[model samples]
Target: MPGRSPRRSTPQPATCRTCWGGSDSGPAFDAYATAWEADAKTLTDALHELADKIRASKGAYGGSDGLVSTQAARVRVGDGTVSTMPAYAERPSALASY
Candidate 1:
């Protein structure tokens, strides 16, 4: 990021001549980004499908309990102290829904 090239450089030229003649580079960049976006979107869709299949086929360790529950505790070790956030418990009233 430090040495990144600025978006626009050179005197008030209408276009960059490196990609296209007459110093115009907008079209080249736009085309490249369009193709890249399409490819990335395709890969993202595939990954999502794989994740969904795995999720659907998951056993008891699915998302329902994937998150570990914890109870509040005070801990100290080697003169160091740390406070941890304990997981919340379902209120007694909520059990009636089962």
Candidate 2:
């Protein structure tokens, strides 16, 4: 990315009165500008979709439910059994259903 212009630069034809103004590579400039616009739009849309998926997946595992699931699993190593434990106990919540 060294020496590359940032994509946020205005997307205009080579002769549009900016750094590219008076340059003879007008067609090449137009091609780059058009590609940048398309790529920027695609990146924006993909980011929005990723954010929505993250928001939807929240809270599926946490608190007491998560702790119970972990404690039930056993791992064997060198003829020894080890069980997973939560780092901290789940806090009591008045709103929590028993």
Q: What lDDT tens digits, residue by residue, belong to model 2 across residues 19-67? A: 5555646767779999999999999999999998876675544455677
Stretches of candidate 2 off by over 4 Å are 1-24, 59-98
Candidate 1 wrongly placed segments (more than 4 Å): 1-24, 60-98
Which candidate number maximizes TM-score? 2
Task: Give the clash count for model 1.
Answer: 4
- Please name the candidate that would achieve the greatest lDDT relative to the true structure: 2
Please provide TM-scores, in order, for all candidate models, with all chains considered together: 0.39, 0.39
Model 1 poorest 10 in a row by lDDT: 67-76
TM-score of candidate 1 relative to the true fold: 0.39
Q: In candidate 2, which residue pairs get closer than 3 Å at backbone N, Cα or C atoms, i.e. clash?
A: none
